[model samples]
Target: MNSAGTWATVTSGISFSQFENVLGVLDVPAMSKNTFLKKEVEVEKVWLKHIDNALVEAGIEERRLAIEKGDVDDGMPFITVIVDGGWSKRSYGHNYTATSGMAVIIAERTGQLLFLGVRNKYCCICDRATKIGMEAKPHLCYKNWDENKPSTAMEQDINVEGFKMSEKMHGVRYKYFVGDGDSSVYAKLVQNVSYGRTIQKLECANHCIKNYTGHLHKLAADKTFPPDSRKLLKQSIPRLTAAARGAIRHCADEGETVDDSISDLKNWPYHVFGEHAQCRNYFCQKVESNENLKIITNAKLLDEITALVSRLEQKAPRLIKNKTSNAAEFYMSLLAKYNCGKRINLGQRGSFQRRCYVAGSERSCLGTKPI
Candidate 1:
């Protein structure tokens, strides 16, 4: 029965009723829903204990690697980590009404989950009790977020909590953080978490390039630009994306120093537009003929592209590191498999957090010995 309940939550994201129906279809005897719920409580306890142990082991390994890599500062180990946040419901980048949100921190060195947290804005028992105008029964409530706070605020809050507890939980500090372009989380960390040193923010390479692509697409669809300019901008999207990605790869592979990589990245826009005077030979052979180059002839379009390049240049230092939050993103994707597209309200009874524990344990234990 406990195994069945575990499967229902970790693999199927099905309620006990759904599991019972499946059992009935198979002509197999199933435990009562009340009994199943009791077993699920046990399952949650076991998974939580396992996840705690796994995180501790991962932290130890991360610290050892950081020291070996000379990432320590003044005898204190500092590791670079990737972080990302996800919501129970899809916001589509506009709507922010998800009742639950989660964020995770993964060590860049070991690709292991260091910390994870979830926030909930609703609790089934509390809401039910309120509806009846009576005192709620004592229960493990999952509601931590205030009703007045926006759902979007959950990400920053969870991230701040994770950062503040890093040293205490893992015996190491997250000196460098690789996250998406969101500045609010980083700003909060700078203000709240006191590691007795500065925490540097590293921009995710993929997000940076993605944002650049989005900007070009937005410009292409704008009516203010001349039709010719818009057409040129549309045509330049693929080329610009390719150029940016190639530049990042080349810089990462061949550049001797971070400064060299930044210089190379800053010069890529000019090279793509047939202004190769500053181009490196290794990057572009500088063919004598400009006939093959799709040079932007529109002055306005050229200015816009130049401005975009300048904006990207300002982020060159962060991009040169080439660090990414892909691991954290992958963990979120795995989490979606368990949560099953927000179709069920798992947050009401602390079930959402237990599911998260399963996901984190699966990720942290992947290709590793079982705890």
Candidate 2:
């Protein structure tokens, strides 16, 4: 067993019934038994041994981060765990489909579980399960007097809030986190990670598959070169990303129209027009055809381009002043849009390094942020 030290967390998925309140609390800090002291389902009854294995499995590398779960914080040992009652089971076409709700636990040291609640993945999680007004604050959330369920977006917000509260109690740091398959839940948590020009180790996580952008697929089409040559090109993906972003920006700035004739065709092919190929070519044709002649990696040119954007935003002429907002917002949108709740997921050369995918649609999400 890993030694109990700094902070540790355990998580599990359970049925709604298992989330019933016993000590006036639902799941964490203490699991409230049902009226008849009902026994738990085999799946919900995960043992400490299993939690033990999971803790190590949850570790960053070969060893665990915390000596024990209790060392989280003195007053509030913020912990979050999930029961991945996925929404995939639900059918949107049919009349309706039932789904087991996701459950979570937030606890403190001495094994006192603080918060326990179940939330449905597809339907409304903001409903009050009981008819009672909020009796007390249930772990940074309002617990209605008679409800067995949460009253806000607490199901997802709690994890975000727990980290904040724990940080407030102690100092904010990535002690440890426990989560499951709910992509939405994970995305909310990842937004808290640090990302900028300098920070090397960004705190993030995701399970979403990275999908390649149109421009990358086309770039990789040349298979004539042997494996070694292609490997070299792949390694220099930073060049690809930088080149594409620069080309797109220049073209857009000049109002150079790139025809998207294929994007709206009646039956778009699965691998249509190559990832970002049309856009990249359009950029090259417009303002700077010489931009990518010698560029080999997206990495080498990053500092220069970033500095250019910064200078343009700070000292560009008045007529072109507002254009900086477009530039800033475009990348900001990309950062948020490309991420699909996967932990530390990244893409390269306009395609997913591993998988290319986006979660639920957010109309406002536009382009990637500087990571």
Candidate 3:
């Protein structure tokens, strides 16, 4: 029991020493050193194996619950999933790059994690065997690698591989693949898979908003507009994004068709800044006043905003349904904290590093009841 509790603590991003201190402070009787002959190495191996088993079981259980609740059809098993990756350098002087590619299927209606998958290339067999007093063996080598130009292409393949495995093991028939601006993710997922062409790509709205805001920021730096007006325009970027999100939500609530939603979204700029009085649905009360409109008199700034609106309008069909990857972002934050926050190497190049994964999977499974 103490061993299990200790492993659970470590899985939750707590250092082992901190776990001991916490237990000592709480007057909890933890495992004694004699339990395993003080073999820290063996303890970690056993704990990580347990975590891996638990993750697999939790995914299967989640799929079962979703089926029972009719969230996933027993025959179809289709789900909506979000994809993201974590890249970190160990800060060792060598400038090595290690990327952890992750995929998570969350409840479409509730946005809770259903399954999580991760891949990284840190499993060099010769390096491991040499550490354990064994001869180098190339036969045991396995790599989650791609020989494509621009190594980041490997990230797309890893993500697709993980998703496909989830489909096979958990009966995941993904209906939507939510991600950021990376076009490669969509292209890769659609090639050579069962539901590839059927999966719809949903771009994260927060990322889109950030991109628009960046364009606005650059435009605001032009020095042609009045400095005071420039400040107002800079301040308006957030308001613009918020208003656009509200408009999208309104269309979604009204059950607007894709074409209608895109049409409505295209009018966001006019609806926001037009000469309308206190219309109750207006995001800004002062838009009716001429003084507020004059602050954005700069032709280039307004054009940039128009361009942004036009782009969003074109993508409104996708953005109208689900607009954010906030859940996936939250999970990734936990993964990072578990990995390198306390200076632990849990996110190191190999699959044996399960702390980050354990943190994500355990929290997803236990933090909330199946919904």
Candidate 4:
């Protein structure tokens, strides 16, 4: 194998089973184990033979699906229905244990990934959360340090027999490439990226503000835009501010530092230069940096929130709590009620007017009354 191939193998995750040898044996009721085995075998057979075969025939040598468009789903698209056995760590706590796995489905649509992870059994009989085909398809997998072979998470993941739905769309045109069909991880990544995308969606406040400011600077130079377009911007300015505020508030709910978050728009290289400038993708170029990424990730979740609030200020001049009032009473309560070291009282008793005096100001001692 080539150098890159060798590296890939070294870093690649272990096989799906990753569980100990089942000795090709089990003790579940004949009905349960029998049914499970048949379904498992059929899934693997189809995945390896159908999906794998089609992708390879079209143009694929490996299954480490990456973050891009894969060949279209064949009418028989590839599907890997995975499941897990009780053994997570060692397989069998004793000398040996049975190997178990789950099977899920996969397919290509509009160049993005689509996955369906199903669960078969629930840890507790009363826990409906783990039941098979439990709607919403939310991932219920988890890890059990005490288990042997199949990790706790994997065990839940493999219960159901997931499969591709629209085998009909074998030939069509669409957009967006789903990253390495890691549906679970991909879904989260897509969400995170989408959130990032929203933040970077448009230069509403700063961009427009800067543009307006620049326009003022160039008032004497070639002024071509009609007054109506200028009016459109002025009107849009408020919406952008609202959007910025929403972004900050939403990020706050996630316990994230909305300010430090980068703009997803930055990723759309075209934003900086090209016909795609107005396109959401192009306009959504995100600003990425270590400090910023941390905020986006809500790693420490420190000053980022304040920064977001500051951005909110820039976006919506009216939203700024320049004066103390009860308008944001509910939001203010969060500061006092939060586990974090957020200050609840403004040192004065009245209502929240502006953003808590910007954290650390010598004037904070001035009491609840306006300084």
Which structure among the candidates has the greatest TM-score? 1
Candidate 1: Cα lDDT at 280: 82
RMSD of 1: 2.9
| TM values, all candidates | 0.90, 0.24, 0.72, 0.19
**Residue 117's lDDT in candidate 1:** 88
The alpha-carbon lDDT assigned to residue 209 of candidate 3 equals 71
Instruction: Give the Cα lDDT of each candidate.
Output: 0.79, 0.28, 0.61, 0.27
Model 1 TM: 0.90
Question: lDDT per residue, candidate 3, 169-272, as tens digits?
Answer: 66657677678888887888889566688878887877877787787787778797678767767777676777777767776777767776665555555445
lDDT of 1 at 151: 89
Q: Pick out the ten consecutive residues of candidate 3 with the lowest summed lDDT.
A: 140-149
Each candidate's number of clashing pairs is 0, 52, 1, 51
The total number of steric clashes, by the backbone 3 Å criterion, in model 1 comes to 0
lDDT string for model 4 (203-245, tens) is 2222333333343234213235444433333443444344443
Show where candidate 1 strays beyond 4 Å. 15-21, 27-34, 255-259, 289-295, 367-371
Off by over 4 Å in 2: 1-43, 48-118, 121-155, 164-172, 175-371
After superposition, which runs of candidate 3 have C-alpha atoms over 4 Å from their true positions? 1-75, 89-96, 99-101, 109-115, 123-143, 146-151, 224-226, 271-274, 277-287, 342-352, 367-371
